[model samples]
Target chain A: MSSKISNALRWIGFTSLEPLLKLIRGEEPKKNGLLVFKKLLVPILSVFIFLGVCNAGAKYLYNIERERKIENTRSVQGEEAAQQMADCIDSGDISCKPNSLPSPADVWSGAKTLVEDHKMITADKKEFKEKTAAINKKRKKQGKSPIEYTGRPSFVDQIITSLKTVFAGFLLAALIAIPAGIVLGLSETLRSGLNWVIQIFKPVSPVVWLLLVSMVIKTILANADMDKSFVISFISVGLCSMWATLVNTSMGVSSVDKDYLNVSKVLRLGVLSNVFKVVLPASVPLIFTGLRITLSVAWMVLIAIELLAQSPGLGSFVWEEFQNGSSDSNAKIIVAMFVIGGIGFLLDRIMMFVQKMVSFDSKA
Target chain B: MESVIEKKTMLECKDIKKAYPTPKGDFVVLEDFQLQVKEEEFISIIGHSGCGKSTLLTMVAGLNDITAGDILLDGTAIAGAGPDRAVVFQSPSLFPWMTALDNVLLGVKQVFPHATKKQREDICKYYLNKVGLGDAFHKKANDLSQGMKQRVGIARAFALKPKVLLLDEPFGMLDSMTRVELQDVLIDVWSKEKITAIMVTHDVDEAIFLSDRVIMMTGGPYAKVGDIAHIGLERPRERHAVLEHPDFYKYRQHLLTFLDH
Candidate 1:
């Protein structure tokens, strides 16, 4: 049972805890202690060191900006105004503090504010729903749409929106890339013919894709009732991130072992059967690698596309916070930054897990 | 000897030539290659490296284009690769993602299209067990060792029930001891199916042990049949008994001498 738990912990990539678990079970304390130091204590020390550096840096930058403001006040106005400015800056006033880089505590408080704001909004939304429930039921019976709250979204809502947009773009890329990659892999002629197009489009900037998508999407979806900015953001994200999957899939498909192909030929398998049963299964490892890269790329580009396209997601949230330029706004931006990074990491782990589930070769 | 009723010809390779155009001119690998395989006859082609033995087998299997003449299977001209001819390659060709049973069932399904699902599975299970892989049916091909993978490959080919079985150095990658074990397993299975078989090999002892006739080929720019030694050893060949047979050394000497040139 201990061996099984150790194996599970290693598989889960929580190897540090394996030694700790062993220590808890009172098996080999000295060796496990050394492992615990190497794995757990060292990483914890590094994190504290990082926070310490951030605290010092934020303090240094704030002091420099505050001194510059005080100097400017003395030069422009008088010593009295300069002393008054110093007093204001020292009073922990939000209006006068330099919002250069947020301290760790500032970020913590910013996250707290966002959570409380989300709670307030939830209460308001629930009250609005209760007030409209009877009218909505009547409207439903009459085949009319129910009323929706038009209030602002919270930080968590923006994260959920970003996730939705990223998933949509990722799905679009897979749907387009996998089939196109299979076709390209199957035929040398098609691969060569389309090679230039892939090479040219693969490295195009997400901001540029957003510009292009906007022009085309507006023209195409002008009469449609759907969200135009959402469509543009997701389409641009898809176009920006699909290249990795396309290239990897084609390479994987074309490089299938000759012996496997011989088996297919000898079996007289139909084209579809040959592709799905032989080609796809053989190429799955490469295909999933491409997909993992595509998902991560999709996420990285989504923020830029959302910022440009005015989509209501983390990208737009960060953009708004930057422009709002409140004393607390920089801390909020930092929070969003960490949230974006955390979500990207989670997305990659999810893709890796899915890849492990599908591929058979243990070495992969 | 006369009571060995004359078996009818099942496969005929007549004037088949394979040529590849190089920078200078056409390089002929094999020209005017001719042979006839009697029904249920096991024929092994023995040659040195680059002697076009594999070329002839692949041509007969309809994988390579016959540049000059025709290959007739039971009177019909062979066109392309089909289930009527199953090949066991030197490398394990089982799909790495599929289990051993699934790999065998892949070929069984293609050949027995009208067979019930249960019957197809039964065929796969039966062949896998015949290859002594009864415990490893659920293991993926990538998980199997080189020798075990070859066992799955042999199981897959036999499950097809093909009219002609082409063995291209099938035991070339196995260790000597595993080679002998798989050879015995092969002979045991062949005695039951007894399809027309053609194998290309570098081992003289393997040729003598398994094949009824061993055909030696000349070295190439244009390789051809140099000599044919008929093995009159009795049915249900045992390895130890075949090794101890007096005429076995004679056939082995004949093949080795031809390959030495």
Candidate 2:
């Protein structure tokens, strides 16, 4: 049982936990204890130290800004005016722009409020559903359809929207890039012919892609009542991020071992079988590396694309909060920043899991 | 007295030449390389490095394109790589993702498409067991040691049931102890199957232990067959007995002298 657990942990890349599990099974406790300390304890301690530094830094900056505001008011008005300004700064007034740099505590409170807001939105949705059902029953008798609920999206809703858009973009990228990469890798002539095009388009900025996609989509879908911004944002993300997958896949396919190819030939395998059996399996490691990079690029560019397209996502949430400029708006935006960063880390871990599953390289 | 029956030739290489085009000019690796083997005969090619022994073997396997002349298997001119000619490379080129059984099954299924899935699987398992890898059927190529990987490679080739097996120094990467062990395994399988075999090797003792005839190639810029020594050693030859034989040293001296020049 312990061995099975150890194997599972090793496969999932939690190799450090294996020693601890072994120690629990009464196998060299002292050695495993040292490993546990080095791997787990050290990282936890480092994180606490970092948080301590950030807390101290935030407090120091807040005090400095508060003092500067008081001094400015005193110089502009009289001593009486300065005291009122100091009181307002102490009370966390929104008028002071310098106070917008929220402390860690403020961001924490902002996160709590967002959670509460999500719960309230859920309650509202339930109530709306019940009300709609009653109204629909009455409308059915009158031969009328029920009205749709178009409420403001909660923070969680925006996050879900962002995830959906990014996935759509990544799917689009994979559908187009992989086949194209395979063809390019197989034929040197085709690769050379298309090299200039790939080179030119690869480095194009996400903002540029968004603008181009928006222009094209707007004209094409002018008559259709579709979600224009959603389509534009995802398409832009796909265009901006696909180059990594394409380049890496081509390189992977081109560098498959010659001996494996010979094996395929000797087996008298058809072209399709040769590719599936020999080319694809041999190049899986490199192709996964490419996919991981492509996913990360898609995530990074998603915010800019969403902001430019004004799509309903975490990116737009951040942008909207910034424009609103309310007292809690800064804290909310900071909350979104942390959320984005956390999601990005999660996305990378997911990709790493998938890459490990597919790759034959044990070290991966 | 035993009835005399003429053995038909299984493989023939007639004035084969292999050359690669370099920027300077055409670099000739092998010229007029020739050999013939009777049915079910084990032939080993021994030479120093750069003698184009491997190139010649690959040419027979239909992996490398012949610049001139032709190689025939059972009176038919062999063209591209086919299921009839299976090769075991020096590096044990098993697909890393596949388990030992799957690696063997891949070739078996490809060659014997009409066979039932159970039959194909049985063929793979049988050959893998023959190579002393019965327990490692589920072990991926990467998980296996170098010797084990080569064993899987041998199993894969044998499972295909090719008319002629070409080995390009299949045990070259292994240590001396493992190489000797695998050579014994190869001899056991070859004698049991009685398949026509052509092996390239740098090891003289290995060639002598495994082959009925050893062909020595001269050093290159255009290497050719220098000598062919027929081993008159008895079948099922034990390693200790072969070492003790007076004829063993004579054949070793003959091959060593050819390789030295």
Candidate 3:
């Protein structure tokens, strides 16, 4: 008993200590401080600080610009606009009093009044306009363009809307591609026949497909809103990358061990349960790998289509920035590129994590 | 007498003939192969490599369509492979995706469809424990050693409580030590469960040790049952003693001579 216990202890100690001992005996940890600063820490910290300063500066400039623009913009007193609109509606100055919620009729009547009589501004508007003219004079001397286009949505709104559209597009692509791929993969007749068609279209650029689909939808399906070009582009991306998933699933299913089929027979696992229990589970690793590849490709291809199709998404936002052709746009493009790449990496990691959870070989 | 008659005879193959189409012509693997298995009777078929031993087993398991003749269970012709018959192949044929317990549960649920989830779990646990794999129940089938995988296969077959258990060289792939250990465990389970078993093997001693009857097959295109010798070795035969038994060598010598042709 004592000998057995000693043997157990020796084995445990040897395994635990061997790696530490190897590390301790490793080549000298010398002269690394200077090398580390040059090779590692300096570059990392430099980029970090540079981005930090740039982002803060951009936010600060944007806020100042917004405040200046809002001040210059003309508007009735909130109290006065509300009172006149309420009185006009309540006292039957118009056909019907607009609701407290400010119906379209109320906004239109107010807009009409403002346009018809533009001399209603108080002294505060005059002072604001004088200050704006002074700033404009100072900017002309310094060689800067005058701020243009009041009433545009803020930069924050544009960024938020772009993010929302990208997410929605990703989800829509997954929903369409996965089931289609699974069905296509399981049937040999479908795989062979459809593969030819897929091969033909797969090489065609998603941008080309998006344009084709958009034109088709516009011509043939004139009933739906043409503004749903984003959905069209997303569907094109899904279709374009679906072949990878279909091929992988078919290959995975085809490669299942012959013994499993025989075992299924002996155990009397009927057709449907055999599919779920044996065929599906055995093919999961390959299928999920295919899904990961498909998702990543779809994500990238959809973004490209969105940009080319003039759709509402991060791709479109980035394209707009590039079209601006400004000095700041270069930095914004770099940021957006990183954002796109980071989201792709995050999505791949999520798929890999799910694969690990569902696969028979979870250690992978 | 009561146990012998009342106990089930799970499988009976009458003049089972199977042939394969070849480039040159047709090649018959099994011709007039017949077998009768009583409940819990461990029967083994031993023959040369191409003697159609496996072909016979497949027909008995209803895996292959018999070219001629019939396979019956309780005097009924088998429609196809059914849960009433469970097979364990030469290599552990457990689905690689399933854990050991899940593999057993697969068979249990199919055989006993009306069984509750809890009941199926218990049945899986009981059989896995019977095969001495109680602790490794959750390990994936591929991760197991050859012996452990076969153990799972055995547990899966037994868990279903099939009327007949068909094992095609279940221990043929294992090292000798694991082979004997598993053989002991299998016989013990067979004694308790009394499910008729038909095993096809190349090992002479395995046949002598496990089987009530060892059916020898002649070789190729005209392969048929060469001999059906009763091992008739006493109950719960000892491993080392059976190896030394004079009659054991006689049986082994007879099989060696029969398969040599």
**DockQ, every prediction:** 0.79, 0.87, 0.56
Q: Write the per-residue lDDT of candidate 2 for residues A122-221, one digit (tens) a residue.
A: 8999899998998889988999978766898899999999999999999999888888888898889999999998999999999999999989998999
Residue-pair clashes per prediction, in order, are 0, 0, 0
Per-candidate TM equals 0.95, 0.93, 0.71
**Which 10-residue window in model 3 chain B sums to the lowest lDDT?**
B1-10
Compare the candidates by lDDT and give the number of the best one. Answer: 1
Which has the higher lDDT value, candidate number 1 or candidate number 2? 1
User: Candidate 1 lDDT, tens digit per residue, A128-183?
Assistant: 99999999999999999999899999888899999999999999999999999999
TM-score of 1: 0.95
- Chain A alone, model 3, TM-score? 0.55
Report how far residue A206 has shifted in candidate 1, in Å: 1.3
lDDT of 3 by residue, B4-72 (tens): 457556678888888898998878887877777776677888888888888877877778889999888
Q: What share of the true interface contacts does candidate 1 keep?
A: 0.88
What is the Cα-based lDDT of residue B5 in candidate 2? 88
Per-residue CA lDDT of candidate 2, range B1-261, in tens?
A: 322987789999999889999999999999988889988889999988998999898888998899999999999999899879889999999899988888998889888889999988998999999999999999989999999999998988888899999999999899999998899888888889989999999999999988899998888879998889999898887899999999999999999888778
Which stretches of model 2 miss by more than 4 angstroms? A1-30, A91-98, A137-146, B1-3
Which numbered prediction scores highest in DockQ against the true structure? 2
Which stretch of 10 consecutive residues in model 2 chain B shows the poorest summed lDDT? Answer: B1-10
Among all windows of ten consecutive residues in candidate 2 chain A, which has the lowest summed lDDT?
A: A92-101
- State how far residue A146 of model 2 sits from its true place (Å): 4.1
Question: Which stretches of model 3 miss by more than 4 angstroms?
Answer: A1-170, A219-227, A327-339, B1-10, B38-40, B138-143
Better of 1 and 3 by DockQ: 1
